[model samples]
Target: MTITIDRRIYNDSVISKALYWLSGDYLIERSLSDNNTESVTITANSATDISETELETRLMQTLNDFKLRQIVADETRDIKTILYAKAFAEDEDLSEEDIHD
Candidate 1:
């Protein structure tokens, strides 16, 4: 159950920053399990127990704002007709089973 970054990580920056926080920069109670064991451990910066308020504050302050809405808009706008067709066909009854020969 050891925590690790997925190998197919499309966003390395996001994963790195999250890993840094999980390793404890501002000191938080985040924990990950040991492989093949139930051993408990704290991050390297575990000088004291992490407080919820402090964790929340650090988390809120470290957020990276991006043009998420704009990206979503572009994706959706380009596929409007495709989406409409899919929506129209979604209500059609179909067999759940797949038959392969």
Candidate 2:
């Protein structure tokens, strides 16, 4: 099945993550068009009885999950930096309460 995805909504990294997961079940061939769209051709394994529509749905869901994860990571980046800095800091005078705040 041939699936077209909007690059504006789904970036290359997100599509790559989705394809990596689905690659075990399907042979994925991907390409980008001048119109800022991505084309994915998925060929299911002969041993699997998966439908094209089902495969497409799974890919979409995977892409969405990756996008959400990216957003969450971006949002928490500063918090992560703060937590790591606190954990690894060598300041003996620092208290746990200061880190939590």
The 0-to-1 C-alpha lDDT of every candidate, in the order given, reads 0.40, 0.80
- Cα RMSD for predicted model 1: 12.6
Best by lDDT: 2
State in Å the error of residue 29, model 1. Answer: 11
Model 1 bad stretches (over 4 Å): 1-12, 21-45, 65-101
Top-TM-score structure, candidate number: 2
- lDDT computed for candidate 2: 0.80
Residues 1-101 of candidate 2 have per-residue lDDT tens digits of 89899989988888898789887877889988666898988887667777777777877899999999888787766667667776886563444444433
What TM-score would every model get versus the actual structure? 0.25, 0.80
**Which lDDT tens digits does candidate 1 get at residues 27-50?**
334232333222222244545565
Model 2 alpha-carbon drift over 4 Å, by segment: 91-101
